[model samples]
Target: MTSRFPTRTSGPSSIASSIRRPAALGAAWAALSTFALSEPSFAQNAQPPVTELPEVTVTTTTTAKKKKAAKAAAPVAASQQAATPAASAPSAGAPAPGSRSGSLSVPTTAEATAEINRTPGAVEVVPGSAYQTSTPATTIKDALDYVPGVFVQPKWGDDSRLSIRGSGLSRNFHLRGVQLFMDGIPINTADGYGDFQEIDPTAYRYIEVFKGGNALRFGANSLGGAINFVMPTGYDSDLFGARIDVGSFGFRKAAVSSGGVSGAVDYFATVTAQETDGFRDHSDGESIRGSMNVGYRLSENVETRFYLNANNVDQRIPGSVTKSVALNSPETAAAGNLLNDYQRNIDTLRIANKTAIRIAPGTLVEVGAFNVDRHLMHPIFQWLDYRYDDYGAFARLSDESRIGGFANRLIAGVNLHNGNTDVRQYVNVRGQKGAQTVDAEDTSRNFSAYFENHFFVTPDVAVVAGTQFLHATRKREVEFGATPGETEFNLWSPKVGVLWDVTRNSQVFANVSRSAEVPSFGESVNVGPTVIPFYDIKAQRATTYEIGTRGANANFTWDLTAYRSEIKNELMCFYSAFGNCNVSNADRTVHQGLELGGGAAIAKGIIANGANPDTLWLHASYTFNDFFFDNDKDFGDNELPGAPRHYLRAELLYKHPSGVYFGPNIEWVPEAYYVDSANTLDTEAYAIWGAKIGFDNGGPITAYIEGRNLSDEAYIASASILDRANANSTLFEPGNGRAIYGGVQVKW
Candidate 1:
């Protein structure tokens, strides 16, 4: 893979960055640890001992009270276990029987547990806590601010490019390789590409990132893996609330939500609106989103839920900045930039449902399905006009149960999805633009079904196996630019793995899986006379292997993973000349890296000797990645571009039981290879630190202030070579010099 933008052909040189001290972080951790460890020994005690059930009557969501059967009428076997407190007693301040839990406060679901255990590959789940109090970013991409291993570059406020373990290369349009899902519904269009604008970060309950084979549960089409954004469920408890915020650079946002029970039913609804005047010229956008879920109880043994989500976004493109422009005026636009001269708008809608049934003792079955539709209108360089429409549907089924004797548990599931898409291109002669005329139209369909099962081979071990079958069909009205737009083929993907429980709180696992990615619209489109003619491109395939460990013990929790992937048909890009470049499938490539992450608590601030506050919190992650081509003829002995070699992020949080808090954070990137293939601009490594302080009234009203880039270091986020500069380049986007913003919130 090469730089997404055109850059000098010289090699890139990297200077190792120096390590710095975070004394504040160390102090915060020590404090938190001390507080947590010294807390009343009773707090660490397992669930309280239980005796016979009380005669108390539990009110159902429907306002219907069911009589508690006499102990003598209890079911035979598990009844004895019910008399004891659950291994994981509810946390302190837990919601009442059927009330909704706070957004980031909900407990993990069954699917989440399956992912935690059955994964034969590396995976990480960042709870909502990471986003609720941090950055003001509006998209899911923003939530990844300090996440390690993953690299997300926001083009503007609403659009971003994401790469994990170096999978989605040569992609300038939609996201490839990585599959995205929300509430079990596919977020990618019918053509298998995802856009960041479709996601509303504020609406999600939690995000799960499954890398390599661990994603087998979703399917093989996701060569880089899958990311699922879960939403609040009816079983959760909450009330209606709204938040409104305004900040620097014409940024504004508002969101509202309602969750509660009303008669044998639980429902949740959320709506949000946001707008921004981008840091660069012509970089402005506005968007609105809404999501809702309702649950119904049919009987003692059955429950069902319905979900709806939608988004509308409008924005102007602030094309890539030239190296010079990027460094000189990072927040300014180029004089006659074609890329940033266009306008684009997107609209999308989604609907889905899930049902769970308790078929027998310790056995349950679940089914889920959803549909998504999206439309995009894009203007190019103020000269070219384009339009696209996509629609897709997905369905899944699975069963969870514990078998006899062996003390074994099993989880098996299958998924089916299909999509259809249409695209058109036109030229706006002279100024007036409105999709002048249809230049191209194509429709594609993908049908796939996958199943995987987890078998507990022993009390301390488990094995997992799964496979996917995908058949695709494409029909194009015209073909001229790149590859044959019309095609058909069937592919099979398989995976297997094992996990060993090191202890009750920790486990280790490893697995190998196969994945494939088909071509995107731009990859097959024939554009003009100077551009190369189209040719059929095969699906990119890869074999990945990963191993990791995760554990949690009252005071400390950590997760780590190491992985490597060898790719065949890695699509790479090359610059030929002015306004000319080519995208060709490579023979082979490799990606390997390690991700270390964990968090710890140390001190007790205002809370009584470790009461209910996370007095001090610490979280950190480090990732090292290396990607290169394997004996390629065209591009020789050159490292893949874009990502830095080593990335590190750490945070130190301090809080007062009264709700006032302060946090200091840092992000470091080791100078690696530059964007260009030639080692020309040997980039230097750098580190940036930030601090945030806030006060909470304890009962709803809260205010906070933050300052980023406190170091005020000169750094570049993105750069590109100018067509007129020959070998010279300019920075397109400059990391903010220093920024300060603040906001307040109120809840009832």
Candidate 2:
């Protein structure tokens, strides 16, 4: 939270005096690593007739022990270009070629094999120059912690508790069965909970994870599916940016963005603010966000776009902490500030619009609309006193054609959600004198219809299908207890897949899908009316299967996947006393997993024998999940609580020569790994290694410094299950130790 460093140069034109040979600035940083593999638009707007794009500055050295590279000094002409806002365009990656109309800027493994060979469910995409030299994360679950079956646990620091595949296994707080979007609106909560501190994850430029039933193009009752966060448009980042970060417990962050064009219109906007002082005890929080996008150009085919997102947050709620206070001291804190000790505020809003048309010539058509609002302020414990307000609206239409020999595409959608909540209760004794209020009023009505298609059977092979039809209604009215209900459920989910391009790089895919879940409002009215009163529980079905393969050229690359799912009713969670909790429905369940990853550049004579074109990259992954529980008898074979069968990550990046850059990484998880659900004790397997260094001058300023866990390993990125009478050897969250940070960045 202290910036100021311009021993010369400040915007306009800089990058060390605009490339004055260093081999043309190493060919303009390899053309910015292929312009950060751009694709995934929506970044427009920035001053008069849209000029933006020209602002880059970063500085930090409040006692430099190590980490100095703030660069600055290079500004001499080309007044503004635009595009780099929207919270600094989440690290802008690029995408804007044919710009809209017939839009096609594929890549990200050909958009995950064209949505796994033509949609039908199950998808994945994580691109942004492949996490452009990571180590600059501000959520988005810490850059999806190395993707692969995603699992985010940020506890008190920035509040995140995501789960994919096993979607919010039983939830403790945020996220429930996936479903989160940005650009197409919807970020949960409107009765369909989801919260990762309104996600800022560095403002995103690419991140699409649809795991079951291909998320029916968004609006298919998530059973762990759907996640889209893309931003960065306007002819591939025009430019004008900003970024700043200060670390350790009392962290701080700031972001900015601005894009190009104006007149024919094209825009961008991004803003962010963050704060943290968490490590337990009275935590502390602060959040701010803003996003904007605009585009127009109604001729030559057609194009239209507009998107806006906003968020505000306030926090303070530590709670969970044990395991002998997390290994003798996981930063202790949380000893009853009781009565929920108040403090938790949030506000969110979203708006969207999209339009694309191209009468013929490859043919294409797209339409979209969106709206979402959420509000929450909760406080309670003695019994349960909550408050919430939700809202929703959505619409979509899609088409892509080629007729002639065969080539087609189509998608359709609709959604409208509503919400309500206001309840109170305080009196489990403890100086009880006055307390008792109610206002259940709940409603979650949904009507959905979806379809997808892709068939080219030849010319590289292709086959994909899709389906979805959901009509749901869940009403609750308590005015004051006693019989208040309304339940109506009707659902259908379908998906099929096939994709074999075996050549043109590589490919393979498979799919089978179905999912339905319904039951909230504290899982059907948290006890009362003498037990089981306001009923409406039915709709928890699942059946998923997946297969995968991936490939890339220019020196090797890879991706692999394998999955399985089977569920019925299943929605268990019964934890009595202390933080109580009870959500029924559990009869059968099974889920399998396997995901291998790849990345390579292993010296081709150090950049094809030309010496320092530098190059050497490697990436890795492994997941084996096995969750089980069939015909429950109070939790069977155990091992079904929060991911862990083996999760791994590895990295090594080095790109040097004048602009230098470094990397080293490893993250592991082992140990019996049972943090709850009657899984008596377990937790071991640990590994840690981290390193990063940076310096780039292609314009604006660039500098970096990082070191995490660097051997101080006392791992536990997530844990929960404290007190099973030392029998469970109690476990409580504990992660974060061994920190080192450095920052400096500026763009314009």
Estimate candidate 2's alpha-carbon lDDT, on a 0 to 1 scale. Answer: 0.58
**Model 2's TM-score against the true structure:** 0.31
Residue-by-residue lDDT tens digits, candidate 2, 715-740? 56676542132432333567777777
Looking at candidate 2, the ten consecutive residues that score lowest on lDDT are 77-86
lDDT at residue 70 of model 1 (Cα atoms): 30
**TM-score, one value per model:** 0.81, 0.31
Model 1 Cα lDDT, one tens digit per residue, 26-79:
332343233222222222112111112112223463332122233223332121
Error of 2 at 511 (Å): 17
| Local error of candidate 1 at residue 682 (angstroms) | 6.2
Per-model CA lDDT versus the true structure? 0.59, 0.58
